[model samples]
Target: MVNEISNPAAVVDEETFSVRRTIRIAASVDKVWRAVAEPEHVSRWFGLVALDGAGVGATGTMTFPDYGVIPLRVEAFDEPNLISYRWGNDDAADARPDVLDPEKSTVFTFTLEPVDGGTQLTVVESGFERTSAPLENLESHRTGWNEELDKLVALVEGEA
Candidate 1:
């Protein structure tokens, strides 16, 4: 059964300009990993996600209903433990690989660890200061992570 969390809060780091959130999921590490790493599973909770490849060095796009399509490239993939991506800083209407700029991208990581009964999931998104509006972007992502992760938890727990 899924143990539901009351409130999942995301912490924002001003010095590093990063957002971090942690939550315990009532699922196995591999289950949580598939939800976050796999494109098909990700689209169910996060957004309309499409990835070119599965392993590291893969490129993809996640199109949010409100935020539109954000170009992303897989930076790290460590099986069911960790998966990370660097996404474009600007929110464009369409996926634009031609104008993809790494310098203006932000890195977000999903890490899963086996806990006593389930898995401990941690998400960290950094490099917000590189965006056009640092503070605005930080605040936006801070809220975004909390809401998005809540959906993740709900989906994983079969509550959604």
Candidate 2:
């Protein structure tokens, strides 16, 4: 098994305090999209994901081993291209998918584009300034994306 780590270019926008990373995956857009958009595939690489629906307005919970369960709601969904979700801003123990509070949430978007022999996946996690610990959250997620995306690439490419 190849343990390739994806060095995502994480940038913290000074104006908005958002974190963004762009990575290239050695997989088709459809395959990458499935790994990102579908709850079943997501759980394999990202975390334990459970979604209520497939399109926008869908709700779900993603429980990370260290971060616990975070409330999430789908904000945008474009098949094989884009999928965005708003998750709880703070690491509160009582976070629940049914209790959505915009004041306590940040939005993360995944955009995929077909490239030569693979897909270009860009992730932008915005609204960090709205969270309780802006800088900490930004740094943590920056590192988290790098590790998780690396796992994603390994999983997808290994299957191919």
Candidate 3:
């Protein structure tokens, strides 16, 4: 049988620094990547609390209503294959700090590959160091990825 989903978080020093989720869709890898890398398509499922949208090298801010706004920047792009970006430090506390960890801000990547039965989509987000960033930082992202991946899977399979 083919695998439909896989989310193996890469752990470092007992804490998950990054959360990676992958889903095997019935559609082509290109189709899956488009839904992930495009702005309007990502807005359907990813908008934080409010949607600012996404595009290659485009920087935007997402409003979170009660959570304030988080700025995001696209750092890499390879059509239908890879996309990386920098976002606010996931470890930032609800209360703002005088200084944010620049290194821990983040760089997320989405890698798409065609598997034997379907498309294998892998998302790897790494930037947090074991000691500097709070463990909660990585945990928050772990939860967010779970929700986002579900939305992505639904969006792609549901569409014609």
Give the winner by TM-score.
Answer: 1
| Residue-by-residue lDDT tens digits, candidate 3, 77-118 | 887788887667554444232223455476778888888756
TM-score of each: 0.91, 0.89, 0.73
Q: lDDT per residue, candidate 2, 1-160, as tens digits?
A: 3325445567777577788888887778998999999999999999888888889999878888876777788999999899999988476554554566788689999999998868899999888787777888888888877788878888988886
Per-residue lDDT value at 78 in model 1: 96
lDDT of every model, 2 decimals: 0.84, 0.83, 0.65
RMSD of 3: 4.4
Mark the regions of model 1 whose C-alpha exceeds 4 Å error after superposition. Answer: 91-98
Model 2 Cα shift for residue 77 (angstroms): 0.6
Residue pairs in clash, model 3: none
2 or 3: which has the higher TM-score? Answer: 2
RMSD of 1: 2.4
Question: Which predicted model would earn the best lDDT?
Answer: 1
